[model samples]
Target: MTQAQPSATPEFRRVAQRLRDDVTGGVYAPGQRLPAAAELAERLGTNRSVTERAVRLAAAEGLLTTRKGSGAFVARILKRIPRRAAALLGVPEGSEADGTREAVEAELRDMGLASRYFPTMSTERAPQDLAGLLGVKRSGKNVLVWETRVFAVPIGAQPTDPGTPVELIRTYLPLDIAAGTTLEQTDVTPLDIRGRLAELGHRPTEFTETIEVRPPLDDEAQFLGLDTDNRVVQLTHSTTAGDRTVEISVSVFPAHLWSFSYRWTAS
Candidate 1:
């Protein structure tokens, strides 16, 4: 039998969309306090609870901010220019697998933009999708998951306000390849995983990347400072040595902050 379709849209989603339209159309100015929950409910002819939930949804999208004992206010949005970056379809001659990140940083530096990499590493069972990518069974096998956030360096800003985050990256490595190595460490490292893998005699001989466009998840939206109406570019990197898949990384870039290009030559 065919699977049934999911349920209809929630009432809060409808309310949220209406509010988003108003905000985009300038009905609500940035930094202006939004109407009270009861007032909004009355205006939309909906219950107060539904209106509150809708406000929360808009807040999650970075379009509104709600203050305790006060009320919701429209957010002052910033427009960030998209930076151009290339994703090579194949490994360029004389280039190592680990050079991509460094290249990106160098390009930004040339444009008077600095970058910092913040990484968090943890040991966990490989998710089913990641297991398949790593050519392993989905039997709750433990693996090393590394999450990294790339942020622009503010010239004279304090650490509390570092700069805008440019991208979010997550890498998965099989236990056999990660155990007893720095890759499994919780501390952030300047060395790339390819360098660590080379030390372990598993240098990848091939690399492939797949790119997709999709809307961000709630957490991703918050991390990238994106609204619900915004989208992101998701790229997957797969590196292999002979028959073994050594690493798989997924990166998410806010659509407004990244522009990708590549050249192709016919055989």
Candidate 2:
């Protein structure tokens, strides 16, 4: 049974529960489109807003899918990705067992899934929290940003399958640190960012990471083919060598598709 959700009204909950029951009871088969908005509203005896709210909640639960122009449908259950074991996502970035961003790509490849990465570079004014984390003043500090999206193409699917986006990565580097390196070049992506930092005398010896559950940001949700009702796993990873922090990365993954396990020692 689904518990009452935060900020959801009694009528909204009632409608959502009915929809969930209908789907589970086989009244609506998997991958089947739901009735029109007016039909659903009339059936539920509620406004279209209430029906939409219910659909959103169901989508978050992984029982329904809401697509633009196509409307909501019963979600077709797919094989689930196993939980990921992590140490700095544990033990820092890159190494296979550490569950670095690359580890996920590796896993997908092993499972016969193919992906293409689209990368872009730009600069953005540092927000207060991130600015402080980078040891810079938000008032004037700007960071070089690299955003990469990994789109998953299904086996034997057409180029225009509109392959799903499985991962979104954003890396931030201080301007002074990136001034003369490949990090500043949008077209030349470094296979190992930490490795490059080492050549500049900044070998990362320690890293800090934080993981939390939350709703996806608007753009994030859209890219991940999700709605506001979905929960997403967000990780903020920072690396440092001795006294200076060298790099920071923020990664977002679909909560339904990824799980993270962390291990650490007590100080």
Candidate 3:
């Protein structure tokens, strides 16, 4: 890709993109030594400082890693595996492996965001629809559940930066299983929770999603690092199993610094 002329976008950003494209376009093969810093600066028609900043940004984005004494080299790229090997092994970042969870957390940390999940309960009656999602009998007693906190951060580490506060999340599961099961053991997602329940003989065949935008609650402000004046984007998802709906979950996100995306294509 050709580099763009510098304007509002930083000179370093343009330099970074050029370097990225060089590696991606095969000009700098995997494991190859990049041009020396001075040489890269000359080639890009910029100074050493701009080139250095670009290299650092690329490294932070996982495109490159630096070595002491030795100059920067192209990061190694593994060869494509055969179909059978690919089927048995998945890389979490690009493949279906469990490592994806850590990858997500790493991305969050890189952006300086914080997250916390806790187990709590709701004494309030499950709404008719939510009760169906959890698969619990409507007439049953009030039950315990899972509550969580999630925070969004800006590009920098400072806490005073503007951010939205959200109520974050609330999840409920059946108490039919022995009481006091550790939260870790019982904290399956709505989709997977039904499967766990089914393993013990329950089936959830229905699910629902409700999304809204609203002001954050007081508790949400404390956990999400939000000012009392901020509002949040809320998503409430419910799932049902058998005659009883067995799971209810709500996820909240700050409005100012959040992004949401989804796409579907022919399978």
Candidate 4:
């Protein structure tokens, strides 16, 4: 990989920064072969391990591409998104309609990405981590945890363009229904979740959300119809009743294709 001289920072950090700057600055032109690790270490006056770590970090940040035997090369710079286009995911002022999930899903089908649902917590089989999240022992009582993945036709060959399908998930419950059945059916929506909780004699008091940006996991990529190399945006949400946490969910959006946008202004 292209090597850069270390700065005053820590050895590994300095080396990583220099490499990032060089790649981003186009000094190491896209697709250009970088020096081999050992040669790069020699050029940077660092050890091989340090050089390797720096290169790995750069690769993870989408700055460099590494081929199995061909070695590493500068990654092509992605086109810079204009502010207007980047705002597509955001909900404009008063533009969101209540009870729009079905409509949205239909549109997604038109785009070629279809949506599917699975439970995070299930009556038949529940993962151990999910058991803990539900505040039960590994083999304790089960609860409903719903997950949904949406797939859309690519705007292009690469999974990094507008109109890509991603997944939005909600892991709430049917309240006191004794969770024997998984909600595999597509008929459930936010209102359905509320209705089920109500039928169980529980109130859907409040819902909260936490947003984050991160890369997609392997399964996430598969569900979103993306390559494993694609990045995703993640948002975690939870619902509660009377100060008790009842449900949690994580939604993943393909970074190059979809984004989440919400707008608020001074009232």
By TM-score, who's the top model here?
A: 2
Clashing pairs in 2: 86-89, 86-90, 87-90, 87-91, 88-91
Predict model 3's lDDT versus the native: 0.54
Q: Candidate 4: where is the Cα deviation over 4 Å? A: 1-121, 124-133, 153-165, 168-191, 265-267
Model 3: residue 52 alpha-carbon error in angstroms = 38
- How accurate locally, in lDDT, is each candidate? 0.72, 0.73, 0.54, 0.55
lDDT of 1: 0.72
**Stretches of candidate 2 above 4 Å error?**
1-56, 73-83, 86-99, 187-191, 263-267
Worst 10 residues of 1 by lDDT: 77-86
True-vs-predicted CA distance for residue 71, candidate 3, Å:
44
Answer with 1 or 4, whichever has the higher TM-score: 1
Would you list the clashing residue pairs of candidate 4? 1-34, 1-35, 89-261, 90-261, 112-153, 113-151, 113-152, 113-153, 114-151
lDDT of 2 by residue, 202-255 (tens): 767777878889999999988887877788888877887778777788888888
For residues 1-267, write the lDDT of model 3, one tens digit per residue. 978644226777678788888777888775688889999899877889888877766554434556668877664431211111111122222222122224444555554554333444444445576665555668755444556554334345366633323235676665654145443364543223444554554444555556687877887655654444455778665545545655566767655444444333444
User: Residue-wise lDDT of candidate 1 within 152-228, one digit each (tens)?
Assistant: 86455477765667789888889877888877766634346776776677766788878999999999977876766
C-alpha displacement of 169 in model 2, angstroms? Answer: 2.0
Better of 2 and 4 by TM-score: 2
The reply for model 3, stretches above 4 Å from the true place, is 1-114, 121-124, 127-129, 132-140, 151-167, 176-195, 203-206, 242-244
What are the per-residue Cα lDDT tens digits for candidate 4 across 125-242?
3456555544554554455656654444433435443333346564644333435332334565443564455455545455555667766777775565444455777766554555
Give the lDDT of residue 6 in candidate 3: 49
